[model samples]
Target: MFHKEGHKIIIITFLLVVAVALGAEYLIPIPWLQVCIQIPALILLILILQFFRNPKRHTPHNDDHIIAPVDGKVVVIEEVYEKEYFKDKRIQVSIFMSPVNVHVTRYPLGGEVVYSKYHPGKYLVAWHPKSSEDNERTTVVVKNKVWGEVLYKQIAGAMARRIVNYAKPGAQATQGADSGFIKFGSRVDLLLPLNTKIKVNLHQQVKGGIDVIAEK
Candidate 1:
């Protein structure tokens, strides 16, 4: 099914496509030129439909496991100093989502949302080495019973303009449930405790809520 975050854009796109197609067919004298105009309009709508498509996922609940928060390629896995909240070393697992991938952001694990904050910054490419820190993004920390605090940051890429975050302090977060959405292409970085085991390798394709990223 489609995601709730895309409802407005989808409807507007549908209307625009209809108008453009009809306008081109009746107004343009050249058949080939009309076809070109309508085709791109149709393709734009199709891309929008696919970008926000959110499929149902049955995530096995486990306090020890951290599921992938978004469908993407595991682009990074390394121990880095988390300057914002942790202020110490943690294993950072970054997943890069393309415009073709599902843009819905899911909770990595069920827990109490202890910290959630937004930061405004430059729109760098999702895979940029400094994008995680310099991009427009939101940082959310979910405190699991056994896992302590699990931090996930949604970083907006050059194509992304808005990063919608539903996380708030004191709210309950369900594992694999919708946490937010990132418009267009983006990346998500999960900072786990030092002892957490990395389950996914770099460049591995992962389905959100279905693929595990790490474990206790």
Candidate 2:
């Protein structure tokens, strides 16, 4: 299935591809030239379609388990001081998303959104050490009786131009539900309690709403 955020772009891309194919079919004198033009046009449309594809995920709901919020590889797992909200030492787990990875952000666990804020900043590479703080991002904290507050940040990568966030303070968040989308590529940082047990390792590939990244 396609994501709602991609509907407009998908339609525009489909029309553009059709126009390009038609122009090549009739205007190009050589078959090889037409093939070259049409093939790339189709490929462009395919890439856009694939980028926004939102496959349904059946999230195994467990309040104690914190699942991966996006489809990507685990790039960072370390204890760091999160200054924006908690302002204390926490285990920060960061997942880096490439151009081809699913860009939909999901709630790691069900809870009430205690804090949600957007920051407009530089578009550094997602993996850069300072990207989480220097790049365009959004910080959201979900609080529940079982897990307390779990904070996650969506950091925009160099290729990303927009970060869509659906989280609002005081709103209810469902575990594994779509929380937002980051166009092109980015990364997500999950800041948990210092004693939280991380289940994933560096370079490990994970799926949004599917893979557990940590637990109490």
Candidate 3:
């Protein structure tokens, strides 16, 4: 199914595609050229629809497991100094989402949102080492009895200009539930305790709200 956040854009795109096809059919005298132009427009609409699709996922209700926040390939898994919320060393797990991947972001686990902040910055490539710190991003920290405080960030890539975040301080975050959405391409960084057991490795493909990325 398509995501609710994309309903307006999808409808607009659909109407634009239909208008273009009709214009080509009536305005273009050459039938072959009209077909060629309409075909590309139709393909573009299909691609956009596919990008915003929010497939239903049944997340296992395990408090110890941390579900992936977005559908993408794991790019980084290492210990890094989490300078934002924790201000200490933590294990960092990063997933890189391309234009074709679903742009929806989900909460990794259920908890009380302790911190939520947005930082506007440069639009660097999502995979770049500095992208997590330099790119436009939103930082969200969720605290639970099982996992303490887990920090996750949505970093905008070169293609993404808007980052929508639903997290706010003192709000309850449900595990594997929709937390936000990023337009086009982006990356998500999860900062967990250094001793947390990682379930996935670098380069592994993950599905948001489906794949378990780590465990306490």
In candidate 1, how many clashes are counted? 0
Worst 10 residues of 3 by lDDT: 54-63
lDDT per residue as tens, model 2, 1-216: 999999999999999999999999999999999999999999999999899999999998999999999999999999998899988999999999998998999999999999999999999999999999999999999999888999999999999999999999999999999999999999999999988888999999999999999988
TM-score: model 3 vs. ground truth: 0.98
Compose the digit string of candidate 1's lDDT tens values, residues 123-165.
9999999999999999999997799998999999999999999
TM-score of 1: 0.98
Name the runs in model 2 displaced over 4 angstroms.
none
Predictions in order: lDDT: 0.96, 0.95, 0.95
- In candidate 2, how many Å is residue 123 off? 0.8
lDDT of 1: 0.96
Off by over 4 Å in 1: none
Q: lDDT score, residue 57, model 1?
A: 92
RMSD of each: 0.7, 0.7, 0.8
Number of clashing residue pairs, candidate 3: 0
Clashing pairs in 1: none
Candidate 3, 1-216: lDDT as tens digits: 998889999999999999999999999999999999999999999999998999888887788999999999999999999888788999999999999999999999999999999999999999999999999999999999999989999999999989999999999999989999999999999999988999998999999999999997
